[model samples]
Target: MIPVFVGMMYGATLGGNATLIGSAANIVAAGVCANEGRPVTFARFLRYGLPITLCQLAVTAAYVMVLSKFLR
Candidate 1:
């Protein structure tokens, strides 16, 4: 259950990052940023997003490992 929850969260974040306008509000926000000459690209987002996502996944794995050991 915990893994599923974590996976869902990861998936949502990934899906959001997949498109510049995935979220309703992001479409407008991205447009504004682009108009201001500061458009965000997928490469730029991935540079930071990948590490952040990996860290979150690692923490989740650690938590699951610790909990399982303690509960046993």
Candidate 2:
């Protein structure tokens, strides 16, 4: 259950980075975690989120480039 919750939070926060309004879910998730006694500070989230987001974006871009090459 803990692993599931962590994974959900990770995905939610990652998706939340897509837009300003979407970030509400990230705040809400952090609040929930705090209430559950596992507080996730903004800095902590940013520390992990930023790198993960960058990596994901990089991978996605690479995939598109490869796909375009194949299609062309």
Candidate 3:
């Protein structure tokens, strides 16, 4: 249960980074980019974000399943 909870938290954290609209820090980044006349698009974000998110989720799952014994 604890490992599952940790995995969920990590997954959520990675998801938060998936979009400029999903997190406060990224919102600021998007705003700044827009102000500079370099607005980021959803497609552009997904191109990079999707792979990163997948990798993060996979790593978190592996950790929870295989390394859970080391936790706590």
Candidate 4:
């Protein structure tokens, strides 16, 4: 249950960085969560979101670097 909850939060929050619609959806989801008593504050969301976003950026950068090197 905990894992599922985390996954959902990550999907609704971190997943927003992918697109405009996603960003809007995450905001709405956050509001809903707050109303339900979960209260996903900016700081709390950042705590989890930042690291994941950084990791994703790192991986994507590495993949592009590798491809560029090989293709060059």
Candidate 5:
């Protein structure tokens, strides 16, 4: 039960990286930053975000694999 919750929570949290506008908070942040005269272009965001997000997702996947091995 706890594992299920943890997995779901982590997945949902990670989904924030699924796209530039994947989450509401990200949109709000971008809007705020833009209004502050520091606009974050989608390309700029992706340049950094894509690699980090992919790496994090990979790590999470590996973790889940190991966790499943143990949990089983």
Candidate 6:
């Protein structure tokens, strides 16, 4: 239960970085970029964000599973 809950929260938080609007930090970065006249558009973010988010989530999920195995 604990590992699952932690994994869910961990995955969610990290997954939030997968988009310009997925997180506060991302939004802030987008705002900064916009101020610099280089706004992070949805398509622009998707190009990089999707892969990174998917990779991170995969890794995190694997880690959680391994940890649960050892812990249990």
* Top-lDDT structure, candidate number: 6
Question: What TM-score does prediction 6 earn?
Answer: 0.89
Model 4 misplaced regions, further than 4 Å: 1-22
Once model 6 is optimally superposed onto the true structure by TM-score, how far is the C-alpha of residue 61 displaced, in angstroms?
1.0
Off by over 4 Å in 5: 1-12
Q: What is the lDDT of candidate 1?
A: 0.65
Local accuracy of candidate 3 as per-residue lDDT tens digits, 1-72:
888888778888888887767688877887889999999887787788788888888887887887688875
- Candidate 6's C-alpha runs over 4 A off are none
* TM-score, candidate number 1: 0.54
RMSD of 1: 3.6
Alpha-carbon RMSD, each predicted model: 3.6, 10.6, 1.8, 11.3, 2.6, 1.1
lDDT of 6 by residue, 14-54 (tens): 88888778889888888899999987898899899999889
Q: What is the lDDT of residue 2 in candidate 4?
A: 43
Query: In terms of TM-score, which candidate is strongest?
Result: 6
Q: What digit string (tens of lDDT, one per residue) describes model 5 on residues 1-72?
A: 655766777777886775678788778888999999999888887787778877887788778777877876
In model 5, pairs of residues that clash are none
Tens digit per residue, CA lDDT, model 4, 1-72: 444444455555545664323477668878899899987767777677677776775665566556556655
lDDT comparing candidate 6 with the true structure: 0.88
Taking all chains together, each candidate's TM-score versus the true structure is: 0.54, 0.59, 0.82, 0.61, 0.76, 0.89
True-vs-predicted CA distance for residue 46, candidate 6, Å = 1.5
TM-score of candidate 3 against the unseen true structure: 0.82
Model 4 Cα displacement at 20 (Å)? 13
Order of the predicted models by TM-score, top scorer first: 6, 3, 5, 4, 2, 1
Instruction: Supply the global lDDT for candidate 2.
Output: 0.66
Candidate with the larger TM-score of 4 and 5: 5
